[model samples]
Target: MKKLSIVTLLLIVSASLFAQGVPEDVAASAASRPAAIVASTSWTAAFADLGGLDDVPFIAPANLIHPPEYEIIVGDVLKINNADYFIYAGYERMMQSMGSSIKKDEASMIKINTNNSIENVREQASLIAAVMGTQAESSKRVAQYVQVVEDGARKVREQGLDQLKVYCHSMQVFLAKDLGLSVAGTFGPGPVTAAQIAEVAKGGYDLIIDNIHNPIAKPFLEVSPTTKVVVWRNFPDRGGRDSLAEMVGENIEVLLQ
Candidate 1:
C-alpha cells in the first residue's frame, strides 16, 4: 500500500511538471514565429495635390465673393437680405405693427420702407445659404459685412443728405460684393423712377428711395435687421458734428443759444 501511494504521488508531480512545460514550449514557439511586416500608409498621398499613391481628387477652396448661379436681381428681388422683401401690399400689415407715427414726407416714408426691404433681403440671403449647405460660413461672412455697414452709417449719421448719399453708396458697393451680388455701380441715385419701384415690387425690390438725395445719385443701402443698419442721430453739435475734432478747424460755426 505504501509503494502504491508513493507511485501515485510521483505520477501527480510528473503531470504538474508536464502541464507547466507544455505552456512554456507553446510560448517559446510563438516567440520564435516571424513578426508581421506592416507598410506605413502616407496620408498626404491620398490628396490630388500630393503625388501620393491615392487617386482621390483634391477639393479647392470655394470663392464666396463670386459663387456660381448667384443673381443680384432674380425674379425682381434686390437680393440684399437673406430673402425677398415683402411687397408694398404687405407693407400696411408691417407698418401697423410698428406702433409709430408714419412720416408725411417721402424721405421718412422711404426710410421706413427701405428698413423693411432690407429685413426681407437678409431673410432671403439666409434662406439661400441654408439651402446651399453653406449657412454656417455665409452667416459668419455676412455678419461681418453687416457690421461694416453699421460702422459706416454711424460715421455719416450727422452729415447732410449729400454726405449720407456718398456714405450709403459706398456701403451699397461693399454689401453687394459681400452678398455675392454683381459688382455694379455704387449706391448713388440712379434713374429708378416711382414707376420702376412699382414694377420692381412685383418681383421684390418694393421699397423706393425716390431720388431723395438725387434722381441720379439714388444711393440707398438695402438691409434686414440682421444687416445691422445703425443710424446715429442727435449729436451734440447742431451743425451735425458729433465730435469736438469735427467742431475744430471748421469754416462753419454754430452758436448755440
Candidate 2:
C-alpha cells in the first residue's frame, strides 16, 4: 500500500511542474532578439569624449540629427537627448505607426542634462559609459581627456590668460569653457559685419575666436587690430589632438613665448 502511494505522489508532482510553463528552450526561441542603441547627434560629442567605439556600437555620421529612415525593431533602443525626432515623429506615435511593439517609458535608459560646462561634459561621458556596461574602460579613456582639459586650464591660468577675454561664436564655446577662458561676447558662425565686430569689441574683449566656417579672422582683426584673433576649428583633425584643445594648447605655448 505504501509503495503504491509513493508512485502516485511522484506522478502528481511531475504533472504540477509541467503545468507551470513551457520548456526553457521554447521560451527562449520565442524571445530571440538582440538589443541595439541608437544615439542622436547632439550626444555624439559626449560619445566622442567617451572614446570607446567598439563598446557603444554606433552607426555612421556621428553628428546626424535624425537617424536614417529604417524599420523599427520592437526591442531596439533609441538614445534621444533633447533632439527634434520626437517632435517630428513622436516616439510613441512612431512606434505605433510602425506596427511593431508599442514602446513604453524608458525607465531603464540613462539621461544627461543640458548643461555645457566642462564638468558636465565629463559627467555625460561617465553616464553614457555606465549605461553601456563599459564604465571602467570608458572612465579610463575619459580620464585622459579630463587630464587634457585640466592641463589646459592650468596652463591658461599660469600664463595669465584670465586677463585675456574672448568672443567665441557658436560651437567654440565648448573649447573656451574647457580652457578656463572668459567669453566677453558671442555671435553666429556665419558671416560677421564690421558693425558687429565694433559692437563685440566695444565691450573691450582682448581676443576674437573666429568661426571655422567663416574666414573672417582677417576682417575682424582688421577692425580691431589691437585685439588678437585665433581660429576655432569645430571638428577633430585626421591625425592630431582636438582642434579645440589644440587651439588652447597652441595659444598657451604662444603665451610662454
Candidate 3:
C-alpha cells in the first residue's frame, strides 16, 4: 500500500509539471504568432514614415522669420526668391571676411542752438540748414577722398610705379564691326600695336590697351576731344553696361536720356 501511495504521488507530481510546461508552450506560441510579427512590421513602417534615415528631423523653433537652413553671407548678390535668406547670410559672411575693407559712412550729429526765444522756429530752421550744408560738404569731401584712394590703387595696379601701356578694349566687337570697323584685327591672339589702337580710337572705337601708357593718348590731349579713351578698373562691386559706360573717358557725352 505504501509503494502504491508513492507511485500515485509521483504521478500527481508529473501531472503538475506537465500542466506548467503546457502554459509555457502556449506563451511561446503566442509570442511567435502572425499578429506579433505584423505588429513588429507595422512599427518599422511607422518609424520609416516619420522620415527616412538620411533626413535630419530636428529644426530650430525660433527660426520663424527665416527657415532653419537659410543663411546669409556678405558680398552675395541678392535676388527675389525664398533662398534669398541664404544669399543674405552669404553676404554677411563676406562682409565679415572683408575685415577693414568694408567702409561705413559716418552719421552727422545734430547741433541744437539754445539761445532762440522770440524767433525760435526761424533760428531752428537756420540751424538745420547750416547743419545740412555742413553735412553735405563733409559727405562730398569724403566721397572725393575715397575716389582718389581707389583711383590711386587702380593706377598702381595697372600702371605700376613706371609708365605702363595698359589697354581698355571692349568685347562689343559686333557693335564696332557694325560701325564699319575691322573686328578680326582687334581681338583674339593677334598682336595689337600702338598704331592699331590709335586707328581704332580715331574711328570712335573703344579700345582696350595692354597698359595705361599706350601711345594712343599722345594724339588727343584736349580737354574735350572728339574721341574718348576710358580705362575701366574692374571690381567686385561694379559690372554690366552702366559700369562699362562709366569706364569710358569722362569727357565723352553720355547719351542716356
Candidate 4:
C-alpha cells in the first residue's frame, strides 16, 4: 500500500506539471500574436492610432459627411472578425446591426468615447492600450496628442481668438472651449431652431464654429453674414489630418484664419 501511495504521488506531480506547462505554452502564443484592430470609423481609428496602432483599417468610408449613418456590409463583418479587437463608438448605425454579434469580451470589442477632448482622448487611449498590451508604445503618442492641444490653445490665445464671441455647434463645443474661445451660444446635433437663429442675428457673435460632419452653419451664416463660419471636423477626413493631434492643429488653424 505504501508503494502504491508513492506511485500515486508521482502521477499527481506529473499531471500538475503538465497542466502548468499547457497554460505557459498558451500564454506565450497569446503574447506573441500581433494585435489586430478594426475601427468602425476614422474617428475611432484616430483613437486607435493614439493607442500605438499603426495600421488600423476602418469600416466607414472617409468621404461620408456623417460616418455614423454608414451601413455595415458583409465585407466589414469579415474585417471585424479577422481582427483581434473591433473598436467602435456606440452611436454608429452599424452598431444596431452588429448587436449581439460582437462578443462582450474586452479583448474583442472596445467602445470608446468619440469626444476629441484632451482628457477624454488620453483616458480612452490608455484604455485601448491596456487591451492591446501596448501601453509602452502608446505613451509617447498620447503625450504628443496632449502637447498638440496645449500648443493649439496657446496659439489661439496668442492670436486673440479667445476674445472673439463665438457661436458653436454642441458637438464641437468641447474643442472650442478647450481652445479658450468665448462661446456665446450653442446649437445642434439636430436642426438649428428659429429661436437660435434669431439669437445669432443680434448676438454679434464673431465666429460660428460648426461641426463638419453634419454641417448646419448655412442658416447661421445667412442670419449673420458677418459671423465668420468655420467648420471643425471630429472625424479625420480622407487624406486629411489622420491623427487627432493633427486634426486639432488643423482646426486651430481654421480658427486662426
- Number of the top-ranking candidate, with TM-score as the measure: 4
List the candidates' TM-scores in order: 0.22, 0.53, 0.17, 0.84
Q: Give the Cα error of residue 59 in candidate 4, in Å.
A: 0.7
Provide the lDDT at 48 for model 4: 90
Model 1, 1-257: lDDT tens per residue?
96455445544543444355437876787568632111001111111101111121111111222111122121111111111111121123223322222212232121111121224335643543343344665455445435544443443343332222112333234332332223322333345445533433343331222211133322223221121122211111221111211321121122000
State the lDDT of candidate 2 residue by residue for 191-242, as single tens digits: 7776786786565778777654345556666566787766644322321223
lDDT of 4 by residue, 1-257 (tens): 96455445544543444354436877788778887678999899999988878868899998899999987665566577557788898999877765544433665889899888878888998999898778987888888888888888999899988899988899999888878889888999899999999998886798898898988879887878887889899988742223678888898888787
After superposition, candidate 2 runs with Cα above 4 Å error: 1-51, 55-117, 193-195, 200-203, 213-218, 239-257
Rank by lDDT, highest first: 4, 2, 3, 1
By TM-score rank, best first, the candidates go 4, 2, 1, 3
Residue 39's lDDT within candidate 1 is 9
Q: What lDDT does each candidate get?
A: 0.27, 0.50, 0.28, 0.80
- Clash statistics: count for each candidate: 25, 0, 31, 0
Candidate 1 lands at a TM-score of 0.22
Q: RMSD per prediction, one decimal? A: 31.0, 16.0, 32.3, 12.9
In model 1, what is the error at residue 241, expressed in angstroms? 35
Model 2 whole-model lDDT (C-alpha atoms) = 0.50
